[model samples]
Target: MPTEILMPALSPTMEEGTLAKWLVKEGDEVNSGDLLAEIETDKATMEFEAVDEGTIGKILVAEGSEAVKVNTPIALLLEEGESADVMDNDAEGTQTTSDPDPQPKEQDGSGDGKASPVTESDTPAPAAPRDDKGERIFASPLARRIAAEKGLDLAQITGSGPHGRIVKADVVDAKAADAPAPAAAPEPSADKAPAAAPAGPSADAVAAMYQGRDYEEMKLDGMRKTIAARLTEAKQTVPHFYLRRDIRLDALMKFRSQLNKQLEERGVKLSVNDFIIKACALALQSVPDANAVWAGDRILKLKPSDVAVAVAIEGGLFTPVLRDADMKSLSALSTEMKDLAGRARDRKLSPEEYQGGTFAISNLGMFGIENFDAVINPPHGAILAVGAGVKKPVVGTDGELTMATVMSVTLSVDHRVIDGALGAQLLEQIVQNLENPMVMLA
Candidate 1:
């Protein structure tokens, strides 16, 4: 029997991705766990693996194809001794185009009416846990695992997945609905209307406005489109509030100078941003109430400080997180941040390296920006925008004027998660940690 090789979802939010490269070709004999292709998601390029051993019968989707939706058949695999006649008939009956419509596969002469893994039915009949004979249940591997963990019986649940395959979501919904008290923890539901901004004018219509004007049209890539969509949603849905503060950085500068000299032999030169990362991490711990993220319906307060630092790249930017930053020394943070930033610029980072941070830091200080507000990334409670440190006249303890290095910072808080008072307290702790560098060491 021939099996359909569908496009695998590389990330949780991945709907479509680019088929960057195909490592296998038609008639190539492949075994389970073999690498078949390289899938380029929005964040990273990940290798796609084969789950069942078979011979590559055909390459349905070509390499370099972009926006290939998840679960779209990319190729076909045939078991040993299976004839190409089985595949030729299948391909002839199906349409092959940029938007291929999923069609069912021919039955393999098995008396059972259950469809094979290669066959896809868009509007499949609901899957029963057991057949008429009361044999073992037919379910997806992920579905079985989730059902076991949730203590739910697969035989009692109906599947809505492709070809009536029991999927992870089916089991999760069943378990949640069957729980003792459903209202206590309501399952997250999708909004009836998408939160996306209304569609803009057609490309031709927009071009008409600039006709006779000098302008070069630049097409947007995957990275640019993703950035646009995400930022738009953040501004429209997330209620954001700004908290401003100014901290004297004279002490941090002097301390950083001394530390850099000691770490010079180890090739670890610390930067002001490194100290900022450490300060933010410790502040999260000092004010644990602020160490939280908006988890759809609930707030998740984390014990470890995973701090994401924004690094600008060619297309857009990447926010690679440093896990447990509060527990690491200044030199360690400097070394780790440099490595992450280098890989990020080269587009070599994996999804895990750049995802899931409770908070983030974006410093345009090195660019000489005085002060600016940063948009809060979704699911994150807040983002710290740090500005350049400049010398300014200040009143001393004895009421005398003196010059000190002052850095302006703006904390962008998600009003849904952090209140105005709580945001102020969090900013105060960050400033206190930066003003007294020795306390961070302690």
Candidate 2:
């Protein structure tokens, strides 16, 4: 029997991907763990690997195909003794043996997991499942139907299948739990029931308004679409508050120059952003209560300072995370940030490189922007938006006016995770670290 090689869900959030390129063609003999294809997900391009040794019997999906759903059969594999002819009847009926779901492999340094390639098996899993909030849940169709028939909630079942997907065997003999009584629907009233949100104008309606005008209509790519959807959800669901602060950067600037001169021999140059990252990392430690993310039901306080920095690319942006940033030297942080940003621009970063962080930094100082509030990336307690450093007059401690280099920053905090006072403390600590640059080294 010919086995169907289904498209894999590389990242936990990936529902579909573009088959960017195929490394193996039909009739090629491949071993387990061999590179099979390049898949372009919403975040980055990743290489898919083979899980079992077999001869490629047929290619079902071609390279450069867009929006290919996960778990769809993309190729066929034949055992040593079998030939391509074995797929003739199977291909006609769209029936073939499929690989069991693959277990998630721990990504290096990235606490998040990535699913491995599937292996030859008897049953096929359905497309990835989703809950009401649109998060992906893995399960087979048979298991779903059985659970529905038994009046059991699939989310409660412990999946024994690969990647922890619920399967028929896991749910067949399970007893249904008691369902909670439904709540009464609230009546719409002027004083009690809230009004529904107004819907946005449709494409046709907007197009009609510009019927006589000439304009270019650009199509949205996967990256752009994901950004739009995620940010929209963030603004709508997350309770956000802002905290603004201004810091004197003259001391930091002088200290940076002195350090750069010594580090010049090692071919290392530190940017102001590097110092900002270190400042935020230390601030998270100083105000440990602010180092947290909002889970659905509770807050997850993280022990390490993992900071994500935004890097703009051709069509979208990537926030590559610097893990354990609080412990790294300034020079090391600079080097790692450069490498991550470079790879991020090239779209070569793995999912783990850009996934988890309790805090993020979005710096537009180089572009000469002066203080702007950034949207809070969900699950992160706060994001710091940095503006340019410019010379400004200020009163010195001795009541004398003097000119100093000042930089403006706004910390967008998630109120659900950090209160206003806690956010202020975090920002104050960051300001203290930046104003007294020598203290950071201590």
On TM-score, the leading prediction is 1
For model 1, give the 10-residue run with minimal summed lDDT.
Answer: 105-114
Collision pairs in model 1: none
lDDT of 1 by residue, 126-231 (tens): 2323443444354544455456557676656786654355555677677533432111112223432232233689889999999999999988776777777788
Q: Candidate 2 on 20-127: residue-level lDDT in tens?
A: 999999999987568999999888898887655678988878889887666656787776787767556443444322322332221111112234443353233323
C-alpha lDDT of candidate 1 relative to the true structure: 0.77
lDDT, candidate 2, equals 0.78
lDDT accuracy of residue 393 in candidate 1: 99
TM-scores for candidates 1 onward, in order: 0.80, 0.79
Clashing pairs in 2: none
Which ten residues in a row are the worst by lDDT in model 2? 104-113
State in Å the error of residue 236, model 1. 0.9
- What is the lDDT of every predicted structure here? 0.77, 0.78
